[model samples]
Target: MADHEEDDLRMALRMSLQHSPPEAKRSKPRENAGVPTVSASPEESPEVKRRELMAAAAEKRMLMSKSVAASKPEKSADVAVAENSVLIVKDENRVLGGTVSEKPEAVCKEEEMKDVNFGEELPAADANQLFSMIFGNGVSRDILAQWSNQGIRFSSDPETAMGLVQHEGGPCGVLATLQAFVLKYLLFFPDELGKFTPNMPSQNLGSRRLSESECVTSGDFASLTEDGKASALVRSMVEILFLCGSKKRAVIATFSVLCQGAEEQSEDGQKDEIFAKTLEGLPIESASDLQKVLRVNTCTSQMSAFQQLKEMLPVFQSRLGAMLFLISALLSRGLEFVQADRDDPSPPLVTAPFGHASQEIVNLLLCGKAVPNVFDGRMDLGGGMFLKGIPTSVEVGFLTLLEYHNLCKVGQHLKCPKWPIWVVGSESHYTVLFAFDTSVQDENELEQWESQIRKSFDGQDQSGGGGFISVEGLHQVLRETGINLPPEKLDHLCSTGFIVWSEFWQILLELDKSLGGMKDSTGLMGKKQFDLFHFNGIAKSVLNGSQAISGVESPLQRPRLSILRVSVPPRWTPEEFMADIVVPPGPGGNDPSGKDTVVEVTKPEPSQHAPLVDCIRTRWPRSICNWVGDPPSIV
Candidate 1:
């Protein structure tokens, strides 16, 4: 019976295919297939053509469903019921245009029940590849040769040395390692380090500026003699970097070096005697052993240990201060603090060179460990490990080589460093850069205003979107907005016969005086300054002007009100005020006073004075006496 049913199904399928429309039939492409296939007659409207195509598809599906149903053979009651259920699911899937051979729920469960190996280890990363990944090809080959001559070797397991590797940010481990070394270098030899200033001069302290003379360039490192102090410093840093691959190893190495130094100084009756006594029996072999001996599991314990180390700084007048500083930094953060979140199905090798730093790299230098983001550093990564963010003002931070080349965007913490000092990295060397003036670090207000203008352009753009519009469209928009540009200026702005937001902004920055000299004056004025200024101005105008009140005959005829107050309902928010406020049209839908006035609020476009208006509404509600219409005019 099954064989007879299969034969009948095959016959029905063959007949259906033979009678199928040409458009519905599947055919292999010919070599010269440029011939345009007619889907429908040209005279047929799109709606009729669409309906015919949908009907053809429905007809094909119906034929296949009927043939499939007819192909079923006689079976026992239970077996027939099960088969019918499967067929119904398949039919539903077919109608939805999905794969028909997808595994059923039972099949999927059986597959899941099979044995699986979750303990398989990934192949070890190559040492040479890891070195290339961190340093990139930009490093001179001579440097690599010099390192080899100095007995410096790449780690066999770079991943282990790098601690927890991030999937997206390539070679952050090396960058972090370099940063740690530079920080230590700054602490130990503040004056001897010619490339960077350890501390800015007192007069220029809060300015966060780096003078040209203070800036360290690649030439400083490149100019180093083979046996100079800087050369030796760089070599020692590279050696330590390779030695400490994992966070555990780094902690061990740091403590072991400190202990070894202390022991040596103890015999000489050096000032480090107190520190030596403090480290008498603490184990330096592993993080766990040291943690047990020091009892530094909690934040309070860590802080106490950090405080002790800091107290000992004055006693170490020599190079040991740098070591103590490094140790204190490590203890404050903890042993597992440097590990980054790993990616699922980790890559076998890191191929990208060190260029753009990940937020993790910044976090490592600013706080410790490559954290997952650049937020204010309040993230909890489980296991009692919380990551702190880089402070707004930092005495020291790292600047990547990519930022110098304009290949990457730097986070604000590093860009506007408190001291205007940075540990700048190059292809094969690291140096210090500092500034004496705040100009370099100051935010450009003109650029910000340009961005706002670009947004306005995008909102009004008709011919094209995305901050782009045709030359003619731009002219129309400018005119509608009450901006009259000279033909020469307009032509220059639209030199390509198209308005590009970036170019538009640049031209306007050069042309507009008000925006050119704007600075972030929020610090100069308190939070409520704008609102206060507005209220003061209004009060002064009312007191000093010649105009009289509505019922008064003359300006000075009646006693003036001593206090002026403006109040808005507590329920009204700034957003609600901006949306709900309306100004009645002047006399007859026109401003006979010839002053700037809004007839009707067509759209709420962003304005340069939006911050001022918002401040007034928020701080002293109902104080605003006037409203600016959408697309505020330049005049």
Candidate 2:
């Protein structure tokens, strides 16, 4: 410690003790001083000055210790509690405040006041803000775009649910087809099926029963004989879910009916009849149509009928719920498995059912440790009790799904090389696992692609793939082609625990810049969902009257405010969608401007092909494109 610093500490300690209760006051000469000075001359040698400082510190420490020990326990407790209140001098010669301390030993006392005051004044830091501060813009939009582009409905609506039940080709189609198939299988071969529709709730009964052939090993009527083909069908459905990584078991079961039917034709002509009767005429919906079915009001009578059916259809509800449960279980399990096996990069399973139970399902999925923000949606961290469960399970809670996944970037995942890169990407964007690899050489694979494309183009179609493709063109082509690298390569590429394109470094820089004197007030206590762009708009409105900081950069980029003038084409009615392709009034009479027409024949003869090329040009003079970041580089 410096001589001045020691003197300050001694003085502050004494002043603090003097202010304490009478019994707690230490009886010493000049004990009321707020600083302790060394009894040395101003002309002392450097070494002598140091020795004096050391001696003064020792004397002060001994005096303070003795005073504390002699003080009554209760008084000592009071002093201890207010120890941080001592306004000690800092080494820089500045005095510390009652709410701050210079000595590390006094931090506890200082923190209590700081925390209380901080909480009272500032809102807790939110995950969405933290993520925006770290990553930049468009994370949420990008995610939604990817899912929408890829047709991966998260059961956001009923139309999606119905679509799953009606699809007949791709994975989604297979699920839909399978649903139809399951209905047929049960209706036709009830003898082989058991426990599937074991017993219906009495209120939901439709007064229908299957024939004798539909009852499998019937006894108690609820239990099915495991030895039958229906049992096999059920078992196969489970396997399909595991392999396809689908959480929708009903969809999987429906798919099984179709897949199995391809090979299992009944020699007695029973399966065909059942399939034709049950599946062919069934009214299934698409994802887009699911929302229409969930409406409270109906303009169409059929909608009303379906609504009534929902109440009357016990068999439909039971089968659908069971299938959905199977899907939910698989999704939950799949999440756990993905997290546990560092090597796994399989696609995640998805399930969402309507009503309150969906919230419970979300909770269960989170508890199973699936990252909720795994999609682009922000965690609804504020005010909603239902949202609490969603944020707690993931590594980065209450942030956008993009932010959470970004935290598990290849570098982060491969921190020890033992953990593989986490899987990221949507169906529209090819999902790829990343890892470090020696064979790749360069850290950026994109750079390699650019280089190859450039070289191939320079070589004039000499490359194996043929065609002289430009670097930019190659990127467009690949993105368009939607071809993805193998999972193993992706894992290898991201094995190293370091990131190149990520914005983590930017956050670190911001933190460092704020550490000196300027404290960062942004931090959250719990999870919350947010849209930064929306918030940004709100912030602009709030700061309309605020003074600009001197020499400080504005965090928000100012938008250019302007007015545009649009010119309408001649001869175009205001009501017309296109004004250019209008037919001119025939040789005259009164103008078609609402008068009877009389032929004047002064007009030149109409060209035979004039109608085909009546091209009109419209001006979109006021179009605007909002963008973030620096102006594009010329290069």
Per-model TM-score, in order, reads 0.30, 0.17
Looking at model 2, report the run of 10 residues with the lowest lDDT sum.
Answer: 530-539
lDDT of 1 by residue, 371-411 (tens): 44433435578999664544344434455444434554345
* Candidate maximizing TM-score: 1
lDDT of 2 by residue, 127-240 (tens): 222222212233333322221222111121221111112111112212222232232233334543443332121123222344455442211223333233333234223323
Q: Where does model 1 exceed 4 Å of error?
A: 1-307, 314-331, 340-363, 371-396, 402-413, 416-419, 427-429, 436-439, 444-449, 462-464, 469-484, 487-635
- Name the runs in model 2 displaced over 4 angstroms: 1-277, 280-370, 373-424, 427-635
Each candidate: what lDDT? 0.34, 0.26
Candidate 2, lDDT over the whole model: 0.26
Model 1: how far residue 286 lies from native, Å: 8.1
- Local error of candidate 1 at residue 334 (angstroms): 3.9
